[model samples]
Every structure is written in C-alpha cells, then in structure tokens.
Target: MPVSKRWTVEVLIGEDHGNTSAVARLDTNDGTHLVGAGQARLNPADDDIPAIGDELAAARALSDLGHRLLLTAAADVAAVAEQPVHLTW
Candidate 1:
C-alpha cells in the first residue's frame, strides 16, 4: 500500500522588543486545508529570545506533525496485521 497523503508546514513569527510569539500551521499538499497548528511564546527575560522563540515554535510544529504521522502509521500497521493471510506449501 502507498500513502497518497502529503502535508506542508508554514510558520509565522511576531515579535516586539522583548516579547515574541510564533504560530506554525500545517496544511495539505495543496495548501488549502489545514491539518494542525502550534503556537509558542517567549519573554524578553529569556536568553536569546528571538532564537528561542523560533526554535520553540519549530519544535512544537514538528512534534505535532510527527505525532500525527506516528499515530497514522501505527494504525495502518495494526490494520495490516489484523488482515488474514494464507500460505500454501
């Protein structure tokens, strides 16, 4: 079996002198339907605020997508395993 499903990821960041927020969205390959969105925020109090915000946002988005993929793969594997198979000698 082949998986015809594909996804795309996009990230947007907003920042002030000390505050930052980032939103990551995942859509279908066509970029029409949204599959998931992840958000992250950073305070100026943190070290390397901009970089930290970006890293957190990217990590959240990637983690979200990775979790989805893992679940889907597990379900497919389980389904295939449940199917009856016959062998002839």
Candidate 2:
C-alpha cells in the first residue's frame, strides 16, 4: 500500500501597531492545497503594545495549527477512499 502524508507551512507577521496575522498552507499527496489565513488585532487594554503583539501572534499560530489539522484529516480520509488497495499473502 502506498502511504500518504500532509505538509503544512505557516507564517506569522506582526505589524507596528501591535497587530499580528498568520498564513497557513496545507499540502497533501492528493494534489490538494488547503489555505487558512487570518489576522488578529490585539486589544491594548492593560497590556503593553509589545506584550499584546506577542499574545496575538501566539493566538494566530494556534488558529493556523487548528485549521491545518482539520484540513489534513479531511485530506487523509479522501485519499484513503480514493486509493486502491492491494493485498498479498
């Protein structure tokens, strides 16, 4: 049986105004490219701008990871259904 795998690439960018954004790309062997891109605006409540930026970046990264995992699981299921099975005794 042939094995299929998923690859994910993520990028996090921070703006000068304490805003952070993330872009995630998920690639699978079945020629599927899933994208999960988002932006996070930090609230300057009591935290400093730098601290807010860090928190926003972390939150964005988690969001990207969650999206990528969902896409990968979906791709795996689809690939399994489409792949041919061969058995040898």
Candidate 3:
C-alpha cells in the first residue's frame, strides 16, 4: 500500500527601516509545528530594492526551516535506530 500525506508552509514578510524580515512556518498532520525566521539589511550605499530584500529574506527563512526539518528527522531516525544519526542535504 502507498501512503500519502500533504504538508504546507506559510511565509510572512515584513519590511521596516530599510530592513526586511521573513518567517516560514510549517504545520504537519501529526500536530507538529515548526517555524523559521530570517532578516536582510539594506546598505546605506546601495539602492533600495524591496523585491531583492523580500526574496533574500524569504529564501533564508525557507533554508532555516529546511535545516530544522532535517534535524527533526535525524532525531526521529536515531530514536528508532537506537543510535546517533546525522542527516545531510
């Protein structure tokens, strides 16, 4: 039998004082919730580009979320295997 599952991630972004920030959140069916945050700062000598900032912040947030998920999976695997586990992307 094949088992199927669906997961979703929501990203929220905000900009303030030439700084951009983002948060990525994941909610799993097993009632597991994970969150990751990221930030980007605009240099005074550079032009203000809102889109770039948004992209950077969102990308970082997603990266952070991915790292967390990897760690969680490693822990779960270690628990089942009765040994320490290291997972990599």
Candidate 4:
C-alpha cells in the first residue's frame, strides 16, 4: 500500500525595537501541528540589514520546527517498540 500526505509551513515575521522575530507554523495532514519562533536583533555597531535579520530568524524557527518533528517521530517509534527512547540531536 502506498500513502501520500502533504505538510505545509508558514512563516510570519515582525520587526520592532530594532529586533526582528519570526514564527514558523507546521501543519500536517495527520492532524499534527507545530509552531516555532525565533528572534534577531541589530547590534548598535553593526549595520542594520533587514534581510539578514529575516534570514537568521527564519532559519532558526525552521530549525526548531525540524527538531520538534524529529522528537515526535522518535517518541512514536518508542511507543510502538515498547521501549524507552532518548533522542540526542
């Protein structure tokens, strides 16, 4: 049997007080949802670059989302196998 499912991710950003923040939302067809957020700030001495902040915050949020998904999967596997599992990543 073959099964196909789709997942969607949305990233929202905000800027205020010389800081940029982003949130990434993950929606899975299996009814699992996850949210992650990250923030970046401009140093007083560093050049102000909105794009840099956007990229850093977005990447951090996405990375957090990925880690969470992996942890969930690991837990599911442990439940089925009837064994305690520890994830290190």
> Who wins the lDDT comparison?
3
How does candidate 4 score on lDDT?
0.90
Candidate 2 to truth, TM: 0.47
Ranking by TM-score: 3, 4, 1, 2
Question: What lDDT, from 0 to 1, does candidate 2 have?
Answer: 0.62
Candidate No. with top TM-score:
3
User: Candidate 4 residues 1-89, lDDT tens each?
Assistant: 67698789999999886799999999998899998888899999998989999999999899898899889988998999899888788
Pairs in clash, predicted candidate 3: none
lDDT of each: 0.61, 0.62, 0.94, 0.90
Superposition error at 1 for model 3 (Å): 14
Candidate 3 lDDT: 0.94
1 versus 2: better TM-score goes to? 1
Superposed by TM-score, candidate 1 places the C-alpha of residue 57 at a distance from the truth, in angstroms, of 0.8
lDDT of 1 by residue, 8-86 (tens): 6777766666455555566776544333334566544566657776676667666766666556556667688996444
TM-score per candidate: 0.50, 0.47, 0.92, 0.89
Q: Over the stretch 24-81, how does candidate 3's per-residue lDDT look in tens digits?
A: 9999888889999999999999999999999999999999999999999999999999
